[model samples]
Target chain A: MRDASETEKAVRLYAGTVYGIALSHTGSKADADDVFQETFLAFHSSAKVFHDDEHIKAWLIRTAVNMSRRAVCGKHRRAEELDENMPGGRFEFAADEQNDIADAIRALPEKYRAVIWLHYFEDMPVKDIAKALGARESTIRSQLMRGRERLKELLGKDWFEDE
Target chain B: MNKIFEDMKTQAMPDESTVNALIESLPEKPRKRGIRFSHIAAAAAAALSMLTITAGAVSDWTFSFLGDFSSAFGEKTEAYNIVESASYSNSASDMTFELVGVSADVNIFRVMLDIYPPEGTEFTEENKPCMNDNITFDFYLLNAHKGYGASGRFDVLSDTPQKMRVMWTYSCSAGIEDREIEFVAKKMTRTKDENAVNTDGNSIITDNEGSVIKTEEIWYTRIKTGSAPQKVKYEPGGQAIDLDRLPDSDERCRIFVTSAEIGSMSVKLNGLIRGDLVWRDSTFTAVKTDGTPVGLIFSGGSTIGGEPSSGLKDGDIILLFDDIVDPADIASVTINGTELVFK
Candidate 1:
């Protein structure tokens, strides 16, 4: 099992992944910071035992996803009113595509957005996404189909076909 | 299919030094994060340290563990060292809880408590008389690292009984462990609400208008009880979960987790809901606030709720009691000797 130092290192290593997930879901630096802090805090508070490093990281992602979902739904985390003092991490998406992707993802609703994040950003297989998200494989497959369909609808079918 | 999505994940990683800097910024010793009674451990340490500091006592700093965690890309989720916290009393007069110190490796920390009243009482915020006549259990965090803090306070009756407990999660380079501590508050309150108990041994008294009167007043008291410091195992690679356990929709839904061992765990969800929330594999689905389908995401990190789907709108209702989610799904509950049946 990873020790405290190792845990810190691991957390540090995954900071980008965590932030990426946060930014995609929240679309704001402030919300991402809260999600980052909250995800680590949840990891700090949880007591489940893990047999290996994979288990620990899974827990962290799970905690971050859960925290992100809460942030999205919570009134206190509105992106328009983020705290000025929040930790700053440069988001380097191309200016034009950034807004397009953000608006499209935001418009897809939370469920679809969650699936798309796991599939695109996290790059999990449909099966893995189902497990990580606490869903059935068949259901996840369906959601993936619909989420891609929605994205195409928002960004145009050519967007997906082109990429 | 989105190359931008793939590219961002690879490019967004923070450098190792940045992570170390963030970790280094943590108080070496345990310090309060904010001034909420919910922050009992760090606040207690802060209160105690202040006493030593004010009395010119040598710095007898103490560090309590909280928890540790890590995550990976595209993996199943996990919780390393979750625990049930105990209750404690915060009777400090002046409290400060926050980060104090940090070393290259160790995050040394401490919390101080200088008790003056029982938990759940508010003292004179201004120079006026201490109204409410209740015991005040104030907890705080004192950061020696930078000089920032937070606090949690409780105002209880002057004569109410009080206790303090601690549940901590310890993290090492390897894994985590759980520790528990319980301490009785130095000051105890014997004050009882005279209106709460009737001479006839009943907790309620009725008037003649066929209206119900609540004779007993429940005090909004906060106790300082949490687990001891324990460490969690960290992993760079992520884990996996079952897809069948995910909520089917995204709308306001109620989750019910039943256990023959611990009775049940439930939560009314307004946002995203997961199915693989508990230790045992169980049912996970999402419905609207009115118990209809909105969306569902499986344990695999996939989702299924949205507009014309199973998502929720504003003004939806969500409620949770004793981990029992979806109050409507529960047929009945017993609180303070009163049986409540949900329609």
Candidate 2:
């Protein structure tokens, strides 16, 4: 088991990314909590030693992805109707367009949502995302391209750049 | 998009209290000095609760229901009764396997096997089966009397240098008796890690996926399944809902909350009109009397195949809540805005 200080530091650093990945995949706060708890518990109990913080982060991200997949594929897996009208977060956005964009991101297919969040939100490169997801970089690129297109379509032509 | 992403990142996370509670719940780290006193105490408590048979030779084994890395078995194995035991050693593979125990139910069958590597064998990061994906087990079940045989999916519950615990489960056919059963364990092959590649100076290997894969035979053994537990019905209280009277709804159905257990809950939705009925995504919430939301442990659904416009259809939906709830504490259940009081 990890020391209390170490666990606290790691949790504080990666909690957002982990929870975001869970929420992106699950689309439900309750499911995300289960993923978050399981991921951390696994980390605490893991016997593998990390070489550095990047390795730790990568392992946690990968574990989070795997756990989210298991949760989605679980026997009790259910489709929870997402409330598109609900606020994305506790705080109000400065611009209403931001909320629209957030909702659009959430509305994307599960496969696309994780790649988009990691790439655009987490600022992780395609290679890292590929390594984290145990997939080829080509797959990540394809997902990013397709996810961007879907997001643009949902937000309308005026909302996205033509690149 | 970047601005939106940034704004979203600023959203709230689980508070510190939750994190602290999780850290506290974690099992104590294994002591560097062989075995600690606390380890024995905790193991004794766990063994007592699990009702596990502690043989003289295997007195050191610690059984846990939490399914942590230190424990040889999971909590689910506690429900099973040990019916058979065998010991086999493979010189070629430098391993010894003991068919420590077995358990079964009507719908599922479980086997617990302890694997021991030869002395001086170091279970390092490079050789650990779980981390390296180096080992695999092929399991088979047979009933010669009835001439019924099939393979089952095997899973490694926990692994350690001292011993590795493996469990497998498959659908149990009717009329299959424990006395007539024969379990077969085929030798496993240790495959080379295909992902391990030389990266030169770069931290990441670009073409690692193209690496060659190779395998060599390792350990193998089989043992009979001992006993099976009686099938128990897990029926939770039921609640009735009139689908026609649901808020903001055109469809009509009668739904009942069937069972609620740790990590999962089930509901039976029946008597649907079934015309153009799309089983689209729906949300269900279990709330306390004060309307505080109870966390859902798991979320999944199974579709009951039925003809459209059949005038009557039904489906069983099971939602896994995060924790068990007291029936009395539950005020109501809301599915897609349709609220129904507990029966």
> Which candidate ranks first by DockQ, i.e. highest?
2
Q: Kindly list the per-residue Cα lDDT of model 1 for residues B18-105, writing each as its tens digit.
A: 5555565543333444312211111001111101001111222111111111111111111111112223333243221222322112
Per-residue error (Å), model 1, residue B73: 29
Error of 1 at A65 (Å): 1.3
Which candidate should be chosen as best, given lDDT against the real structure? 2
Off by over 4 Å in 2: A70-96, A157-163, B29-343
Q: Compared to the true structure, candidate 2 yields what TM-score?
A: 0.39
lDDT string, candidate 2, B1-343, tens digits: 4555677666625556666777677667643532111111000011101011111222322111111011111112112223354444434222333333333332232232322233345445433333112112222222111122222212221223233323221212111211111222212221244542222211110111322222121122122222211122233334445453221233333333322233233444543211112123467787878888888643323222121011111243444444555444666567767665444
Off by over 4 Å in 1: A1-3, A75-92, A158-163, B14-18, B26-343
Question: What's the TM-score of each model vs. the native?
Answer: 0.37, 0.39
lDDT of 2: 0.42
